[model samples]
Target chain A: MEEKCTNVCQNHLTAVGDALYVIGGKWKLRIIIALKDGHNRFNDLQRTITGISAKVLSTELKDLEMNGFVKRTVHTGTPVIVEYELTGYSDTLHEVLSALGNWGTMHREKIRAER
Target chain B: MEEKCTNVCQNHLTAVGDALYVIGGKWKLRIIIALKDGHNRFNDLQRTITGISAKVLSTELKDLEMNGFVKRTVHTGTPVIVEYELTGYSDTLHEVLSALGNWGTMHREKIRAER
Candidate 1:
């Protein structure tokens, strides 16, 4: 029984740590949601997800793209257009996003109620 | 349609942000899992969740206690004992933890396959 419990807890700890590594940053989730909201242009994404500076946004975008959650394309034209979109792989995280969002919403209400 | 999406995405962003703000630290989730693993004392928690320094573990415990996710107790005897346990309220986050754990497991498999 003790061995079983230890194994289970160890798995949970490792799994949770892995999840945090992928989606744990301040701007990653917000940036993903903004793209889902149809913000494709660099400037548009910056505007939609407020308070994210250009340097930070660029770094995060690169990380997300590398992680396979985001797709970035450059259009060759008189003015080069760069767009960002969520890849289908990112949809796999729907459950995670929903879980976090739901808990956060409930927690906010609880905090406000106590206040 | 655009306005509606904006509102919905805004809510998701806010909710995700709130959730992350509470449980998003490097050690908080790991610490919570350690407590759930029945490692109630400080040294036990530090040992179970390896790599956490005494200072960081101390601070994270204080944050978790302040956020109402953990209960710290003291018992005076020949040698005073200190113990930590999850609060009933912390159970509310079972869904969040499960979602993250499941997703993380899947993600690990995916990465391994890609490699």
Candidate 2:
């Protein structure tokens, strides 16, 4: 019974691990962060976010939409524009990312000091 | 000159994006959260973490160590114990994960309410 319980627990952890694999990607966080400014289009996002390749950006956007962190709507007008917006799942990330941003600020300062 | 400036800026953003790739991963945040409890070992982490496979756990731990978020030490006294601890890089994650954990709690509550 104890062994069985351990196996079940391990299974649960693996599921969580799988979930994190989706959420814990490189551009996912930034794409969501950019969306926090409200709805943004593909070109705008590419322009605003410095280093994202068109391929990677497209991939991350699709992943974020699938994960429920973002919603993409195609506007039929004006060259069939597509825009992305944050979902409720993303509202939760705002605070978390803000905290991370603060950490990055401090981290960069520390690195500068070390140099 | 404008194109050159754009290239340099893009390079900076790419470097930052690369940094995020290392920081953002399935077990990286969880491992940091677990280590916040202070020193933990391979099996202990496997136990506390619910669902990580040994192969994945080993890989994540090695990556975190490489990224400076964790430090691994080997103890020679008894059975050659190995332990992992948070590094300065991880100290920053404490606040970020705390924010994330808080988000998870509220998120779960909302999910339950919907059900």
Candidate 3:
């Protein structure tokens, strides 16, 4: 029983570690939320996310793309246009995002109450 | 409609930011999970977590305590004993942790498929 419990604990740790590796950084979740909100174009994302610089945004987008959460499309036109959209896999994070948002609000309230 | 949408987006950004701030580091979630799994002693946690140093574990526990996710109790006896446990507030993250674990498993499968 103890060994089984330890195995379960280790699995949970690995799962959490994996989740963090994909969505762990400061900007990943923010960027995912932005894309989910229909801010698809590079400039639109930059403007909507507030203080994110273009370079950091670019790097994060690439990371998201490589991880399969985001799809990037380039349109050739008078001026080349680039857009990013969340893949179906990214939609799997909706529940996680909602949970995080709720906890965050509660945490903020707790902090405010203590202060 | 646009103004309301923008307001909602900003609120989400803020909430997510707050969540990350509270549970954001490399070790915070791991520590929380460890404590949740009945590993309370400092040395036990250090062993269960596998690459965490005593210094990092100590810092993260302090942060978790400050954020209300963890409680620390000191027992004074022939030898002083310190133990950490998850607070009720930490239970609020059950859904979030489950979601993250599920997603992480899926992500690992996706990566394996690609490789």
Candidate 4:
């Protein structure tokens, strides 16, 4: 019985691990939320997401793009404008984000009550 | 206006940051899931959560306890057994874990489709 429980738990552990790997970094979800309102250029994202350094934002954006959560576009214009936007695939995370946000609010209240 | 947007985005960013801070480590969620199945002794948790080192498990358990998500109880017996259990507060995280697990399954499928 214990062995059977371990096997089932192992599958759950892997799923959680995969979720964290894709969206686990300090900046990924923040960047995603920043882009939620609308598409953003590099500087705009940096400003919108408070406290994110330019280099880290650049790297995180690239990772998001690679993971299919974000789309990066380059416009052929006099200034060659570049923009980043969330893909449809990224919309799949809305519930997860909301869940995290709701839990965070509750956790904050719990901490305050303890103090 | 962009200023208004920044203010709202800042609030969201803070919430996400708080959530990540509490449950962001590689092992924290795994440990939480392991405890979800049942109250477990230290050695049992060590086995249930694959790949976690004894030292890391010890530290994470302390953090979870401090954060009010876990309760530690010691049995006063000849052998002095210690057990860890998830608190009701930790049950609040069930939705978040489920969302993560669901998203993770989708993400793995997405990756496989891409390759």
- What residue pairs clash in candidate 2, if any at all? A13-B50, A13-B51, A14-B51
TM-score of each: 0.94, 0.70, 0.90, 0.89
The reply for model 2, stretches above 4 Å from the true place, is: A1-22, A66-68, A87-89, B1-19
Query: Where in model 1 is the C-alpha error above 4 Å?
Result: A1-5, B1-5
Every candidate's DockQ is: 0.61, 0.26, 0.56, 0.61
Off by over 4 Å in 4: A1-7, A113-115, B1-8
The structural similarity of chain B in model 4 to the true chain B, as TM-score, is 0.90
Compared to the true structure, candidate 4 yields what TM-score?
0.89
Say which candidate scores most in TM-score: 1
Per-residue accuracy of model 1 over B1-115 as CA lDDT, tens digit each: 1233378988998998899889887789888888887988888888788688999999999999999999999999869989999999889888988998999999999999988
What DockQ number belongs to candidate 3? 0.56
Task: Give the RMSD in angstroms, all C-alphas superposed, for model 2.
Answer: 5.7
Model 1 lDDT at residue B66: 98
Candidate 3, residue A19: lDDT: 91
Residue A104 displacement (Å), model 1: 0.7
Local accuracy of candidate 3 as per-residue lDDT tens digits, A1-115: 1222277778888988999988997889999988878888887888888789999999999999997789999999968988899999888888779888888888788888889
Best prediction by lDDT: 1
- List the candidate numbers ranked by TM-score, top first: 1, 3, 4, 2
